[model samples]
Target: MADVKLDIRPVGAALGAEIRGVDLNHLRDDEFAAIEQAFADHLVVFFPEQDLTPDGHREFAARFGELEVINGLKKLDDQHPEIVVLDDAVTPAADVWHTDVTYRESPPITAILHMVECPPVGGDTMWINLYQAYETLSPPMKEMLEGCTAVHVNRYGAGNHEHPVVRVHPVTGRKSLYVNRIFASHIRQLSRPESRVLLEFLYRWCEQSRFSVRYRWSPGGVGMWDNRCTLHSVVNDWSGSRIIQRITVLGDKPTGLGEPRWPKFEPNANGASDFYDKNYPF
Candidate 1:
């Protein structure tokens, strides 16, 4: 394929970029490759004024990889199970910092969100560069976290998995701080109280404004993120309705700097008593 030139503009000093002169509904192979490269460099890339239907959205997202169907989440299109919808009526629970589907054995590698409706003001989304979050850690703290693993439980009572506290990005081969406040239950190597204190500290540290970038949404706007190395949060200050459709690309099980370990027995038992099916959430 011939090379395609794209107009890319960085949105902030931290982790976002806005790409111009491309439409998601009609993208060439070279254009898609350029967008993919930009996504890797920026962690989160936004495209404004590209209108896409549910089918169009899924088609564009599928270009990245196989689409991940999120079970137990509301779907916007019955025929297109890949299109997961988030709106005001459900009271968005993702306001806390999180990487999508970390409780699963293999979490999503990328997430594509398209804005369908937006209030007159507010309802912006924020993303943090986890790679930077790890690099900026003090030497002693980094040493302490080197070989630790953490348990991430599905809050909805679906499943649980152990992931390295510092995960190596499969694509970029860079280390990223992998724990989040929403799903990470505790560090396996630390005592309960010690785990709680360290997790809280890491959560607050990762959320520092220096490592994040906030994006304001508009109709027909699209945000695509590399979920393997970032944590995102949606601002819920908007009173009026807001809607966004999302598609997640399937990913491999997270691998870290050293040998991996699994729990001896099922850790998800004794939760809410709901039948736990292997489900992925956005």
Candidate 2:
């Protein structure tokens, strides 16, 4: 919570908002701080009725931090090397319920997705709050997760990358449950059966309807999310074409600055963690 606030219309007790009085094409520094604070507070900020160009999208993303280069997509212009092009024209295989790239040792902290094209009917994105998902766990469950971490990897299908089952946001200082369905292979150092049971249970808890938000797109929509502690997916049920311009803000290790009551999180030193045989498809 900060001194000044912005217009936030929560989608649920955990997520959702429609911020007003700001334009991506021209935003002041203090105004940008307020928007960032609101994003940190709400986990998901929505700005509708915007028709941003590829250049506009890049400019807006740079205001936050460095940009990320994604593996797929073809529409991205060579001028903006960091922008990720997402659309039906790129790859035939669709992206399932998963977070962006968690393969790197320290993954990108946030992603700004701006809707440039949308289906006339459906094409919504869903965001789940891992913080609230962790908080809602029974006291016994919370205690059980203490000091626990898992591996998520990049795979041919949906990769299994290793990340902490529970992680704390470095900048915002909030704890989040980090295991995602796409990359969560097996908990490191655990037996097969044990890892299976535990991961299955945690996935169910995080995907529950209560701690999430779903946004239906209308061309000019943009969503900025803290990927450190949040899980999100784009809806592909639209049966038609939907395009979005995306840029990710590179982040340090989730446990970089350290915390009072949590275990230290580190996978590799080169900002890319050591890869293993989790063998997931991206």
Measured by lDDT, the strongest candidate is 1
What TM-score, to 2 decimals, does candidate 1 have?
0.89
Model 2 residue 206 lDDT? 91
Highest TM-score among the candidates is held by which one?
1
Tell me the TM-score of each prediction against the true structure.
Answer: 0.89, 0.84
RMSD of each: 6.2, 6.3
The C-alpha stretches of model 2 lying farther than 4 A from their native spots are: 1-5, 92-95, 157-161, 256-282
Model 1 poorest 10 in a row by lDDT: 273-282
Q: After superposition, how far is residue 101 of candidate 1 from its true place, in Å?
A: 1.8
